[model samples]
Target chain A: MRYSGFQVIKEALTGHKGWKPVWRDPEPQSHYDIIIIGGGGHGLATAYYLAKEFGEKKIAVLEKGWIGGGNVGRNTTIIRSNYLLDGNEPFYEMSLKLWEGLEQDFNYNAMVSQRGILNLIHSDAQRDAFTRRGNAMMLNGADAEMLSTEQILDRYPFLNVNDARFPIKGGLAQHRGGTVRHDAVAWGYARGADMRGVDIIQNCEVTGFRLENGKCLGVETSRGFIGANKVGCAVAGSSSRLMSKADMQLPMESHVLQAFVSEGLKPVIPGVITFGAGHFYCSQSDKGGLVFGGDLDGYNSYAQRGNMPVVEDVCESGMALMPMLGRARLLRMWGGIMDMSMDGSPIIDKTHIDGLYFNGGWCYGGFKATPASGFCFAHLLSRDAPHPNATEFRFDRFSRGLMIDEKGMGNQPNLH
Target chain B: MIINHPLLGPRDAAEFTYLGDASLINRPDWQSETAAQDFYEYGYLRSNPAGIHRELWFHEAGDRSWLVVTRNTVTHEISNVEMARDVARTQGRSK
Candidate 1:
């Protein structure tokens, strides 16, 4: 059912009974042309692009639990293309563009708000680095503006302008960078894929890959054995665990990252703001709650909960940046497992096994890279070639010492 | 989270630095035939299990001793704590 303002008004007048389910809850089929593992944002988007754009048939997206129960729903929802490296800027810029027209394309109200994102500059060294980063962003055709301290103060009056240790010097603002309604992204893509005859099978966990010689035949799932000509694994934090069944250990670790939200209040934060001295990044959600998060718990764990040390550190950083947050009552917090890659970048490439592709190692930034990750993974799965934008995200890059080390952190998954 | 140090009874987790899986201590020979592949696998791949995980933690703020802690990843429950030097020696490693 196509939705529009007219349909909304009509449904409102008719007691809202004409609305339909966003996506079908389908049973797993015995065979499919392509099978996608993990029904998160990337997996659903891959299936959506495969069916709607690539015109692929007999596609199935297998989920262990419900869709959007993974990192897609457990994020701060900020999206931006303000990156320094050439290996990352273009891909993320493409994702930002996709987010721009996503609602209209998927026919879902995803609430893509390009309110802007500001990365505050503290020290002179940080200003220099942010200047280089802004230039790099502009070189990649992404919007970037270096804002003065006065301009930043004019925008965010609640910030600490002259703290004893770290003073806000300037900022790098991307006018197109902002947050999206994260859950709507999953629903929209799932609906789009399902409308295109793609089967979205929930409660179907892939136990092992059906490997024959060098090629993958299908997958062994909780439901049963399902045959597929090609299998794409887009599982995020569980990449290593899942690939271990195939005797392939991934170059990533599962680390839990926590996020928090404050009780609903009047809208004060106009855009996403990130601290320069610390890891605190925050934005006001549409529901008026202040959503924020900080660094990882700094350990390897699959547990979707974090300890108090990191939580205390995050709140400390928040207080350092904005003292007004000290009074806001904390509503709740949650954690999501991140596939922290060795170089702090993602890996979207085919594995040593033929007909078996892998898409993961997104770390904590997977939420922002959802669209491009899916589109590029779909391009790779369909054509058996890396997308031009994702040419550097190969699994063999680590062995060849050709890593896209965005943060210059070497081989430390948790740090990434 | 608190790590029960072998020397010190219990230490706050904030005082220690994490170095990930204990398998990292098994450093392969540099002059081996498949040194490149071995180093690649050694430096990159990991058995990031969801259950009991044996990992290394350095007491940076205390005795500066490297310790191996066997803990459950799911429940964050610590079961065993031993000096990494002893664990490495038992696994046939010496300076």
Candidate 2:
């Protein structure tokens, strides 16, 4: 059922019992026109767009577990498109735009907050770099502004602007970039796809791909062999493991990236603020918890838990940027397996095996890229061609020396 | 996490810096005919298995030596450790 203000008031008047499950729990079908693997944000969004926008039928999204169980629910929930490169800016800007209209388009409350994001500048080089990045964002039709130290201080008075080691000189602000209710995004997309006659199958693990003669026919799952005319794998964290079953080695590794939430407190952080001199970014949740995260654990792993070194490093950076945060008690911490691509960017393209498509290698930035990744991936699966905004996310970019190294960190996956 | 360094005994994992798969030591020959393909595979492709992985770790905050640590990716359990120099020598790299 479509939720609305009228429905809410009527349900409230009628003792609040008119709500239903967001999406149906359907069993896997034998065959489908298109099957999307991994029912995370990307997969569910792919199904939603495939049906709603592309007008495709007989679509299915297969999930190994419950929805919003992976990185979709494990991220710090920040979204921004303040990128510097041509290969990335337009695509992420498209994603930010989609996020703007997502809640209304999907008929769900995703809590899309455009409460601005500030990337703090500590050094002259970083300022120059972020200045170029701001120009690039504006050039790509996204909103950007350079905030002086006084302006930043006016907003975040608690920020340690005059720290001895890393002084905050200025900041690059994206007024359109902010956090969203990440789990509701999954639920909204799932409900939207379900409403559009797309099947979302849960608790079905794809054991292997049904490949023959250099073409994929279907997948061998725990339930049974489910045939599909086209299969798009959007499993970012386990991309390597899943693709290996098809005998295709991806140019990426999996690393554990951790996120943390502190005990609920007064709303201290107005929006998302990232420490430029270090690897820490934070946003205050609506419930008053301080959400933050930092660099990866810097090792290849399929595990969803990280070691303590990175956690200590993250807290140190947070303390460096905002010393007042030292008094806040951390409520909990969690990790997500990031499909860290070699060039530190995502790939959305067709694989060598016919009828088989791959969409992964998102590194730790998959949350922000969710909408565009799914839309472009659906476009590719339906049209068999990369979207104009995503033309650079190809499998052969690395071999062809067309790497979209956004952070300019070379082939180091962990650094990215 | 603790890495039992071959030369320095048990050491905290914080003392080390990670590079990546130990296979990187076997760099492809630049002068080979199929160098392009070989280098592409060598530089990008990864096993990234969920089980035990032999990875290179440099003891940046310790003895300043590289070690090949055979660790389980799923459980974060370290099984074996050896000097990367010895492993490279055994893989037939000569100066």
Query: What's the i-RMS of each model?
Result: 0.7, 0.6
| RMSD value for candidate 2 | 0.8
Per residue, candidate 2 scores C-alpha lDDT tens digits across A1-416 of: 98989999999999988888877888888999999999999999999999998999999999999888999999999999999999999999999999999998999999999999999999999999999999999999999999999999999999999999899999999999999999999999999999998999999999999999998999999889999999999998899999999998999999999999999998788999999999999999999999999999999888899999999999999999999999999999998999999999999999999999999999999999999998999999999999999999999999999999988898889999
Q: In lDDT terms, how accurate is model 1?
A: 0.93
| Candidate 2 chain A: worst-modelled 10 consecutive residues by lDDT | A20-29
Residue pairs clashing, model 1: none
Model 1 is docked with a DockQ of 0.90
DockQ of each: 0.90, 0.91
lDDT per residue for candidate 2 within B30-88, as digits (tens), equals 99999999999999999899899999999999989999999999999999999999999
Q: Given candidate 1, what's the lDDT at residue B59? A: 96
